[model samples]
Target: MTESALLVCPHCNAVNRVPSARLDEGPKCGKCHQLLFDGQPVELTATSFQKHIDKSDIPVMVDFWAPWCGPCKMMAPQFAQAAAQLEPKVRLAKVNTDTEQTLGEKFGIRSIPTLVLFRQGREIARQPGAMNTAEIVRWALSKISR
Candidate 1:
């Protein structure tokens, strides 16, 4: 029997059940009719963040950032690149600390550009700083098996 994964839609916050064997084949949401993985980081808010983290069977990597932080801005493009390289295996997301102060506080995020990797709704490891695309991808990949 083929297994399936529960993936939260990045665009509409809809929960979807996708076959694990067909993840790379490009699945669409049954509700919004949107592609499940669009090769980009999902912008998460306080309301949607929990659902994505708790429901997704795949691992989730979140970049906690703010608009005024220089390092955060510098890492934006690199994070996006990392998303393109990591999806189907992991889900990349961005949470703006400025806008989502509660989430930042809940996660104990003290600095901008903090990368938090979550598995099964729990944070496994977190890194505080800016990293290039190569570094980001490498770091994220290294944590999956842990």
Candidate 2:
């Protein structure tokens, strides 16, 4: 039997069932008709955050950040670049802690630039700090296996 992956659409918050083997074939959301992988991180608010992590078969990497933090600002571009390279396989997302303080509290995020890797709604690994594009990519790739 062929297995399918459940992906939550970053565009319209719709859930899509994609064949595991065809994940890289540029699948479009059934409801929104938008490309699922757009080579950009999804800007997630607290309301939309739970569904993405819980429903997505692929790993979800979240950058917990606030706009006023220097390190978070510095890593924003690098995070975006990493998202461009890692998409379709992994869903990259960002949560502005300043706006989503409840999410920050729920996740126990004490730092401005924290990277959390989640698979099946469970956190697998976490890194707190700013990293360059290469580092971010490498770190995420390494953690996905766990």
lDDT for 19 in candidate 1 is 89
Per-residue lDDT of model 2, residues 1-146, tens digit only: 13999999999999999998888899999999999999899999989999999999999999999989999999999999999999877899999999999999999999879999999999999999999999999999898865
- The CA lDDT at 46 in model 2 is 86
Clashing pairs in 1: none
Clashes of each: 0, 0
lDDT, candidate 1, residue 24? Answer: 93
- List the candidates' TM-scores in order: 0.97, 0.96
What is candidate 1's lDDT per residue for 57-120, written digit by digit as tens? 9999999999999999999999999998998899999999989999999999998899999998
Most TM-score-accurate candidate: 1
Against the true structure, candidate 2 has what lDDT?
A: 0.93
